[model samples]
Target: MAEYSLRAASEARELIVKLHNSCLTHINEVTSSLKEEFEHTLHLESDLGQWLDVLKGRVESPQLNSAHRDFGLSLYAAASGLYRQAFSSSRSSLEVFIATTYLSASEFKRRQWVSGKLDISWSYITSAENGIYSQAFIGEFCPAAQSDRDEFVSLAKATYRRCSEYIHGNVATSQLLPTSIAYDKEIMREWISLSRTTLLVTLHCFMIRYFTELDFGQQRKVEATLEDNLAHLVSVRRILDLPVERSDS
Candidate 1:
């Protein structure tokens, strides 16, 4: 397996931390702004206001328990070592984001069913289940994603499989057996870049769909800020020869 110097590992970890912080900041800002806007403009007793309340609950619930945030923190903690743990966390983050995006795109009936309200015996929605839910979400709601559906699914599956190898004690786990506890800078950079990009893209789509009433100017400003923060990760994606899409999809 490839190895990296301690300095290289430290630098990569720092960059990952920066990206993680920026992403969380953006999420908080957007959610706060949206909540304030809704509270000020919509009457609580009105039908639309009630609907907004439900939407807000749903959006905020997942944001609070975000696997993306959890995984990002795990990556930062394992920056100097624990390669297997980092990969497992990354896989978990991806699966959670996929499920969130799918729920946002699905119809109300489906969402209720997934929540187990419609059928007490039914299992709650969890994993993306081999990209089926994600594929459906992209097809129904994300126009830009539809064009690159095959590539998106392929990349997501490949990333999940690679992470799963480490998690499931497969042959690839041998890569983590080095005596020196350090991660390859190039590998860590790629993993963080991909994870951050996937998360931002999914969050962008969810926000756009949920905050449909957000004014154009405010929406543009929020998106511009997110893009600015993501600039370095985007560059890393290019350097690593990964797929790149400027849009949320």
Candidate 2:
């Protein structure tokens, strides 16, 4: 018998456990370096989770649930140095949230989606003409914010393409990844930035889709995140109804 042939299965199991233990230790070692990202990670989780908590019956869907679940998984994957998987999961969650917003406008299309008859086209979702970020969509939902559509359309497109680079394993992305799991602060920081971008884009869609319809209490629940991330946007400022200057009357 070959010296290690019979024990291949056992060796594999041991290797898996060893890798898992190494990831845990790496997580500890990198905590200080990732302070900002870790803080933002916690904040993003809370923003999405709390927003859902307040949505309870208003916007219920298996897709939304799954999207939120995947967002959480992305954070865990990042902590474990599964950077590629982390970005992929984040992109999927972002896609689902945008898709949910798009489908909320039409039950027929939504049913088609649920039945797998219609597809979730990222191009359609971000299209400058008919997408969630389009002036037409915003005009219908919250016309006060129509002027800002192009900005978010750009953001949505850029963030999605950034994640897709990782998902498709372009030459540069492949070269950037490690052969084995190990903490990569540069990539981890980038993931954190992408996570924020994902949240910002998703929240922008939700603001147009659901904000006006939310009861004052519901609006109050998500306002902090909305303000913190998007207060600079003319559209978001309008949605939040921040005070306007009147030159002291």
Per-model TM-score versus the true fold: 0.51, 0.91
Worst 10 residues of 1 by lDDT: 40-49
For candidate 1, write residues 1-249 as lDDT tens digits: 135687788899999887677545534543354444323222211322222334444643453256546565545544545556667777776666555554555557446745767532101332244243245544544333344444445566666676678678886555544444443444554455555444544444444344344555444434433343333444323423456787875
Off by over 4 Å in 1: 1-60, 63-65, 107-136, 200-214, 225-249
Candidate 2 residue lDDT tens string, 98-122: 9987888888898889889998799
| Model 1 Cα shift for residue 22 (angstroms) | 27
Error of 1 at 239 (Å): 26
What C-alpha lDDT, on a 0 to 100 scale, does residue 231 get in candidate 2? Answer: 85
Q: In terms of TM-score, which candidate is strongest?
A: 2
**TM-score (C-alpha, index-matched) for candidate 1:** 0.51
- Residue runs of model 2 more than 4 Å from their true location after superposition: 1-6, 245-249
RMSD of each: 15.4, 2.7
Over all chains combined, what TM-score does candidate 2 have?
0.91
